[model samples]
Target: MFDKLKEKLGGFKKVLGGAIEEKEQEAIKAGHVKPEVSIKKEAPESAKPSETVKAPEKAGIFDKLKAAVLEQEFIIEEKSVKDHLWELEMALLESDVALPVAEKIVEAVKAELVGTRRKIGSDTGNIVETALRQAILKVISVDSFDFDGFVKKSNKPVSIVFVGVNGTGKTTTIAKMAERFKEQGYSVVIAAGDTFRAGAIEQIERHADALGIKLIKHQEGADPAAVVYDAIQFAKAKHKDIVLADTAGRMHTNINLMDQLKKVCRVNDPDLIIFVDEAVAGNDAVERAKLFNSAVAFNGSILTKQDADAKGGAAISIAYTTGKPVLFLGVGQSYKDLIKFDPNWLLDRLFE
Candidate 1:
C-alpha cells in the first residue's frame, strides 16, 4: 500500500545524499586551504658564533591529505546523525504529530544520545539502532492494540458498525472490511445507513457490487436506525457470517446526530463498534475519537490513509485516549489496502 510513498521517499533520499556529499567536499576544500604567513623573530646582535640550526620537519602531502580526509569524515559522521534525527522529526511533524508529541520525541532521542558511549566494534551500530528504536517505541507504546484477542470463533455472525466524522473514509472502510471478510470465506452483508450524503448509498452499492456481497439501503434521507434494523434482520435471516454497517459521518458537536447514532446502536446492538478515522487528521483525529467514544462507545478503530504522510500520532494518541484497540489500518486506496494492525510492524517502521 505504501509502495508509491516508499518510491517517492527513495528518490528524495538520493537527492539528499548528493547534497550532503557536495557540502562535505566544500568543507574539505575550505579546511585544507592554506593561508600565507610571514614569521618574525628577534635575534641577539652580539658577536657570537652562529649555532647550526635545523628547519622544522615539513608535514608530507600524504599526511596533510589524510588529516583533511579524517576531519571531513568526522564532520560528516556527526552531521549524518543530526540530519537523520532532524529528518525523523520533520517526517513526524508532516504526519500531523502534535507539537508536544514531536517535542517529546526529539527530547527522548537527544537524551539517548547524550553522554552515551559508542562501542569500539560493529556493536557501535547496534547501540545507535537500539536507542532510536526505544525512543520511537516510548512515544507510540501508549496506543498499541492487539487484534488476536478480538477474533471471533462462534458460529453466530459478528456485527461490526463503522462510525466517524464526515470525510474520514467510513463508507469506503466498510467496503474494504466486507471484501476482507468475504476473502476469509465468510458470507458478508453490508448495511448502508449513511443516508446523509447524496450518493452515499450508491457508493456502498458499487462496492457491494464489486465484492459480490449483499447490501441493504433505504431511500435518501431515510432514518439510519431503521436501515440498520433491516440490515440486521436480513443478516439473521440469511445466516450471514458477518454484518458490517456503515453510518453517516457527523460532527461530534452535533447533539442531534449523536442522539441518532445512539438510537442506531440501540436498534442494532452491534458486537463491534469500529470507528473509522483518517490517519492524516493529526491531533484533531484524537479529539474526534474522544467525541465518538462519548456518543457510541466504539470498541475499536480502523485508521485510514496510513500510507499518506501522516505522523502516525493520531493512531497512538487516539488508541491511548479512547482505550480502544486498533483493528485495521488503511495503508492505501486499493482494495487490499486494509491491513490488520500490528504494533510490532508499526514500531519497526516508526523507529527503524
Candidate 2:
C-alpha cells in the first residue's frame, strides 16, 4: 500500500543524505568543523623509544576524543533544504497529491530540516526519515472522530447514512459496517434506500441475508426518504442497536438527486452521515469529497479500495479538504478488512 508515495519519500531521503555528506566534507576542508580522525599520532616506526614508553596509552585520551566527536554539531543549511525540496514536491504531485497539500508537506519538511542541528556521524537515513514522517503526520492529523467511542456513548439504535458518487462502493461499505457492528454485540438493521439505481436493492439484500441482519427497503422507484424513515422505525420497534442507511449514488452536480438526499437527512436526522469514496481516485476523490461536504455536511468519511491505492494522495487529502475525519479505510473486499484510520498506521507503512 502507498508504494508510490513511499518510493518518492525514500528518494528524498537519499538526496538529502548525499547533500549533507557533501556539506560535511566541505566544512571539514574549510576548517569550519574538525573531522573525527583529526587527533592523529606518529607512526610506530617514527616514535622514539622513550616516547613510545612501555605502558599503554591511558584510556582518558580515547574517551575525550570520543566525547568530542559525539558533541560535534553539524548544521543543515537553509539553502540546501530548499534546493532538495523541489524534487520532493514534484514527486508528491506526480503521486496525485493536491498542489496545496504537496506544498504543505514540503514546507513542513523544510521547517524541520533547515538550520537543524545533528550530531556528526549520525545516521543520515534516520534524520531524513524523521523529518518526512513528521511532515506527513502533521498534514494528516486533522480533526478526528472516534467511531467506536461515539457508538458506545450515543443512544441505542444509532442511525448512520452513507453517501457518495456511484461506483465508489458505498453499498458494500454499509454491509461491512453492519458486520462490524454485529461483531461488537450490536444488533443492526440496514435500510436499502438506494431506490434509483438498478439492482441496488437486491445487492444490499444479498449482503443482509449473508450477514443475518434485517433489511428494510422499498421498490425500485420508491422514495428513498421513506425507506430510511421506515428503517429507523423498525430499529426502534425491534430494539436494534444501530441503523445503517444506504443512499442512492449521485454526482454532486445532479441537483435533483442532491435535494433528494437532503430530504432523507431532514426526515431521519441521523446520528452521523458518512461520505464514501475510492482511495485510488486521487485528486478527483478529494474534489468530490469537498463538493459533497458542501452539499450534505457529512460527519466523516470511509475510503474504499485502499489496498489497491499506490499513490495514497486521496487518503491524505480527503480529511484536510473536507475538514472531517476519515473514520475507516476499506483495505480489502472482506467485511473484516475495514480498519479504523490512524496517523501512525499510515506513517508506519510509508516509512517501514
Candidate 3:
C-alpha cells in the first residue's frame, strides 16, 4: 500500500550493506578479525568508469551508487515479487512498527510464501499480496469487538460510558457517538456525568439538543455517580436504545477523582466503557490508557484527532499495551468523521 515510501527505503539497503562490508574489511586488515572472503559479482563496464576522468556524468553520487549496486546479479526464484515484499516490510518499519514487531511480520511473510512452489506461468505478485495481507493481520490481531456482533447481541438501552483524562476529547466523542447511534434509528441519550467541570453539563446538553436526543445532567459540582444513576434510570424508564455517559476528565494520579469514576461505573453498570484519548498525545496517551483502565476498568478505546497525528504511534501502542480493542477513530471534528475500527483499513492507512 505504501509503495512510494517502500521504494524510497529500498534504495538504501544496498548502500547500508556496502558500508557494513567496508567496515568489516577495515577490521580484518587491522588484525582485529580473521579475514573472510565472499564472492561478489563484478560491476558492469558501464557502471564502473573505464578510465579515471576529471569529470564523468553529472549524476549525483546517490544515483551513481544505485547504478553500481543494481549491476550485480542475484538469484531470487521470484525477483520482482520478493523485491515488492521487501519494500512492504521497509515501509511498515518506517511507519512506526517497532523493530521486533517488524521482524515478526517479516518472519511470518517468509514462512507463508518464501519456499512455496508455484506454477511457472502463475503471477507471483498474487502470492506476495497474500503474504502481505496475512502479515498485516498477524501484527494487528483483529479478533476483537465486531460492530455487527454488537448490533445482534446488544439489547435496547445499551449503556456506554466514556472515560479518560482531561483534554482527550471525551465530551466531543460522546456527541459523535450519539450522532452515530441516532442515525441508525436507535434512541440515544447522553448523560453529563462530568459534573466537575462548570460547563460540562451544558456542553453535552447542547449536543443532545442539536441531535434531538434526550440529555440527563446535574448541577455543577454535583456527584458524578449520582448524575449517572439518574441518567440510567431515566433512560430505562424512557425505553431509550442507548445511553452514552460522559465522565469527568481527571488525571489518573488523582486518587479521589479516580475513586469517583469507579463510583460512576458502579452506579451505571454500563454495557461498554470506552476510554477516549488523543492520538497526537503519543506515549502520554499510553499512560492515560493505563490509568483509565485501572480507574473504571475500560472495555475498549476511542482515539481522537487522528487527522492531525502524523506519527500515529499511539493507536498501535495503546491497543497493544492496554489489550483493549480500539472501537472508533475520530479523524475530524464532524460527526461523520468517527470511523469504526477496521484493522485492515487501519494498517493500510498507517503504512501508506
Candidate 4:
C-alpha cells in the first residue's frame, strides 16, 4: 500500500544506519572503542602496556581515569547526523508528506541520533531501525481506540456517520463498515443519507442487496437528517445493533452544505462521524479532513483506496494533524478488503 513511501523511507533508514556505522568505525580506528570480538575481554592489569608504549594523555593516573570515563560515552556528531537527517527530510517531502509532518519526522530522527547511549560495539543499524520505528509509531498511532470493541460496547442502534468529498468512495467505505460489523455478529442497517447526489440511493441499495442488509432511504433531494432519523427508528423496531449512515459528499467550503451537515448531526446525533478520504490525495486529503473536522468535530476517520496509494502521506498527516486515529483502511475493492488500522502493523510494513 505504501510502496513509494517505503522505498523513500528505506533510503533514509540506510542513511541513518550508515552514518552511525561510519562514526562507530571512526571511533574504532582512532582507538576510542574496541572491536565487537574484543568487547567482552577486559584488558588485564598484568597485560598493561609498558610506559614507553603508553599514550601520553593517559600517563597520569587522573588522565587514565578521565579516559576510562570518556570511553563509556557514545558520541555522534550533530552536524554530520544533521546532514543525513536533511536527506531524510527531503525524502519524506518527496514522498508527499506534509511539510510540517516531514519536518517533525526529521526532528524525531535527529532527537534519536543525538545523545543516545549505545554499547561500545553494538550494531548501529539495529539501533537506527529501532529508533526510526518508534518515531513513526509515535507519529501515526499516538492515541487509539479499538474500533470493533468500541462499537460492540455501544448502545443498540449506534449511529456511525460517514463524511467526505465526492469521488473518495465514501459510500463504499460505509458498505465495507457494514460488512465488517455484520461479520462481527452485529445486525446493521445502512441509512442512505446522501440524498443530494444522483443515484446515491441506488448505489447503497445495490450494496444492501448484495450484503443482505436493510437500507433506509428517502426520495431524491429529500432531507438527509430525516432519512437518518427514520433509519434509527427502524433499527430500534428491528432490534438492529448498528446504523451506518452515508451523508451527501460536499466540499468543505460549501457553507450551506456544511450547515446542513450540522443539522444532520443535531437531528441524527451520530455516535461516530468518520471522515473518509483517498490516501493517494496526499495533503489535499489532510486539508479536507481538517475542514470536515472543524465543521463536525469528527470522532475518527477511514482512509480509502489505500491499496493504490504510493506516496502514503495522507495516512500520517491525517492522524497527526487531526489528533485522531484512523479506524480502518480500504485496501481493495472487495468488501473483505477493509483492514483495521494499527500503528505497529503499519510500522512493520513501512520498515520491514
Best by TM-score: 4
The count of backbone overlaps in candidate 4 is 0
Candidates 1 and 3, the one with greater TM-score: 3
The clash count for each model shown is 2, 0, 1, 0
Candidate 4 per-residue C-alpha lDDT over 39-90 given as tens digits, one digit per residue, 9 for 90 to 100: 3233433532231112234232222111121242354546546666777788
> What overall lDDT, based on C-alpha atoms, would model 2 receive against the true structure?
0.83
**Each prediction's TM-score versus the true structure:** 0.68, 0.88, 0.69, 0.89
Candidate 3 lDDT (Cα, whole model)?
0.67
Give the alpha-carbon lDDT of every model. 0.66, 0.83, 0.67, 0.79
Instruction: Write candidate 1's Cα lDDT for 1-352 as tens digits.
Output: 3333233334333434343334334433455311122211222244133221111234432111111112112112333345555765666556556666666766676677544322211133344445555665665556544443444565456777888899988887888888887777789889899998899999999999988999999998999989988888898898888888888989999898889899999888888888988888868887888889988898888889978833567765666567776778988877888989866677656444
Name the weakest run of 10 consecutive residues (lDDT summed) in model 1.
62-71
Task: For residues 111-133, write the lDDT of model 3, one tens digit per residue.
Answer: 77543433222233444455655
Model 2 ranges off by over 4 Å:
25-71
Task: Write the number of the candidate with greater lDDT, choosing between 1 and 2.
Answer: 2
Off by over 4 Å in 3: 1-133, 350-352
Kindly report which residue pairs in candidate 1 clash with one another. 95-310, 95-311
By summed lDDT, which 10 consecutive residues of candidate 3 come out lowest? 66-75
